[model samples]
Target: MTTDALIPHATGRADDPQVRRRAARVAGIGYLAIFVLAIFANFVVRGSLVHPGDAVATAADVAASESLFRAGLAAFVVVFLVDVPIAWALYVLFRPAGRDRSLLAAWFRIVYTLMLGVAAVFMFLGLQLVTGGPGSGTMGPEAGMLMFEAFDYAWLVGLVAFGVHLVLLGRLITASGLAPTWLGWALVVAGVAYGLDTMAVTLLPDYAAIADVMLLVVALPSVVAELSFTAWLLVTGWRRPRVAAETA
Candidate 1:
């Protein structure tokens, strides 16, 4: 009997472990690029300080807000467009073909990533409208508030899906022995943390900003773990593609 017929079709490719590992390494780089872009983009998206107590004062404030909002919108588009493809590519790398399960996972990742992009766009629009003061254009304060709410709702879904994907990925990585156990655990933990944070923010208004901060904390270790995994994958190239029995 052929080994191919005996083993389940996990990878979508022609069982080329080398190609998959290369894809994983490239996906890691894409993740790194995303991290860099997000961090750098923050500076441009900050917008002139909207003094707490003071009323909407000057045109410059409005101009700064508009500029920041537009930058945020543009970033959202880029992030979404880039992320969907990245997720699909990565999914292709790691999927275990059991009917359409792999396809479903890939689709969820794409949906969640796209949703996140939509959320970002909504937030940017809301911020821009609010910055325009009370009666700027068609949207008013109420509309801005609604936009924020929509953004938050959409983000909740994205985070949940993303968390699930990460947890599954961690399990896959561990089973494959592509990286250290600690790295696998880190992915699982980061995924859970983000998932929980998303839930918390949705239910508790007081913890909204706190949730965002928590995600950053979770991400720090997660990124480091990922970088380590990338290094190993690039260097070793999954030399011993761990057998199912071995993982067991």
Candidate 2:
């Protein structure tokens, strides 16, 4: 919550539109990049390899596509590094709306990023086990899969924090006209969906019955709402995307 104290003069720059605008651009670019990298790492690489119940096949697939798995690990590494700047960018961009709220949002995102970093560590450990690296401890697919799954669950926890961040941003957007008001509402919905899905996965012993539906619940709003916000930030430039008077 005391994030303003952590960053030098962040509060001092809150009223500066130039600073916020620049941060918005940086945030837009960072978001787009993170979006691409996360999709590749989560879907293209691990999605194709990590079988939920079949450790042996998962191992076989990863062993066959060792380089691809390694690339996924590398992508996660880059993601961890990039998330810090993006968090700062978001904080700086949104600070003008509400200093304490923006600071809290940034800290939430930073917490999420810490979880992501931990997830990446699990991913690296999984990779080392699979590839027989120094971190390997005679572990096979069972251990490897566990590490990979740990990565996933840790990432899930991060998403929970991300949901909170989105909710705060939604309020900021509605308050400040930084983006469309409808987009703020959509972000709130998306953020709630994220938290709901995380809770369902965490609390329910059997999630298969609701997993597909929950996936849609989370994915659609995120793709539409979050992407729309990012696009606005990219195109808005020095002009307001939506007039302040038009905000509801």
Candidate 3:
């Protein structure tokens, strides 16, 4: 009897190489959406709307640009929504490497998403606090500033979970031999950067003094890691040929 006849294949249909390739491509697109929308919302819109340590000014800025503030909130909502499928797609694409580890990574990302979603409520509340509507007069500029700061700190907390996900994902990708080893190393670096930055912000008394320098140090590796991985998924889908796995 042939070995094929004697030993049945254990892989499921979702485990098919073609399916994984398609999933990888979708995940890549999702990553691009996340990167672009997050940058726009967090940096561009928030930067324009907020003035550090000046609650009255920040509130005035947001109130003056109400439509823009709403748009930024919407962008964050979209990011939270996209994150759900990205988690599942990544789990599907990487599960072949180590199912348990992949699942753990996915859960970490999901937790981060949930935390961000909760944080977004603070953004919406900030809008209400700054708007010229009922209850707006009751709350002062300080209240609005507190809401915005809550949103920022909440996101920073979420980053901790996100960092864990990246570390697990980086390890998986490096071991899989399906992606460039350099990309995996970059991801590890990014993960470490995230953790360190979070610690600085949360635990350090001199966080403000060093914040800009820390951001500069963390930015490059994190951007390169994510963008490179994203481009690889979009362009190559997967490095390994489907035939090899199919025949095996």
Candidate 4:
């Protein structure tokens, strides 16, 4: 990284229209790809396989669909690969609003992404058990479930950081006045929902009983705000809005 890149410069460096536009485009595309792949891996692939409290079933599912499980893991790898560039793109896109805040937001997301990488490693552990690989004798269905749970909880912890990133991202959007203010607010609300849901899941032993409702609470806002923000990046972020408020 260049020295100029290391030190957070003032807003003027990022105020260039073309630069912001390019950053927006890059982030938009990367975000779209990661979102789609993640959803597919979690819902279509793992979702179908993993039973909340049933270890034998989960292990059997993974074994029956070993190839799909591998594909799902590959999908995660793709998301992580795309995540680094998205972090940099987001930083560039928002630094004009507030350099310090943008830098912090990017760091939060990078940290979260690394946590996701850890979750993927756990998924690999589960795969090893299913394939009769090393440690298979020592590991069984119960242990496989434990690995999967580890993946989920690790990723859940990561979401807290991701939530913070989203909140800061929302503030940047609103501060810059580069996109619709409502969208920014939506992002903020979504961030809070993410944190709250994570907290509940962590603290409440019977969270599963109300998982559906909480999922709605988090998923509704998350989908709406993030997808809308992605849409904005694609359609409107690069260009200056009719009224933009820049910080000094």
Judged by lDDT, which candidate is best? 4
Tens digit of per-residue lDDT, candidate 3, span 1-248: 45333222335454677667766766887899999999999898998898879998998999889988899999999999999878887887888888899999999999999989988999898888877556677887888888899999898889889988999899998999767888888898898898899888988987999988999878988998999989987776545676786897
Clashing pairs in 3: none
Candidate 1: where are CA atoms >4 Å away? 1-14, 42-62, 96-105, 131-142, 145-149, 208-217, 226-248
Better of 1 and 2 by lDDT: 2
Query: Candidate order by lDDT, highest to lowest?
Result: 4, 3, 2, 1
Q: Report how far off residue 182 is in candidate 3 (Å).
A: 1.2
Q: After superposition on all CA atoms, what RMSD does each candidate show versus the true structure? A: 7.7, 5.5, 6.6, 5.1
RMSD of 3: 6.6
Task: Summarize candidate 4's per-residue lDDT along 1-248 as a digit string, tens digits.
Answer: 45444323234467766667767777888889998999989999999988878988888899999999999999998998889888988898788788899999999999899999999999999888766778789778888888899999999999999999999989888888877999999999999998999999999999989999999999999999999989988884445654564531
> How close is every model to the real structure, measured as TM-score?
0.69, 0.89, 0.89, 0.90
Task: Report how far off residue 185 is in candidate 2 (Å).
Answer: 1.0
Candidate 4 clashing pairs?
A: 21-238
Candidate 4, residue 173: lDDT: 80
Off by over 4 Å in 4: 1-12, 237-248
Q: Whose TM-score is higher: candidate 2's or candidate 3's?
A: 3
Residue 35 local lDDT, model 2: 89
Q: What TM-score number comes out for model 4?
A: 0.90
lDDT of each: 0.62, 0.83, 0.84, 0.86
lDDT of 1 at 152: 64
Determine which window of 10 residues in candidate 4 has minimal summed lDDT: 3-12
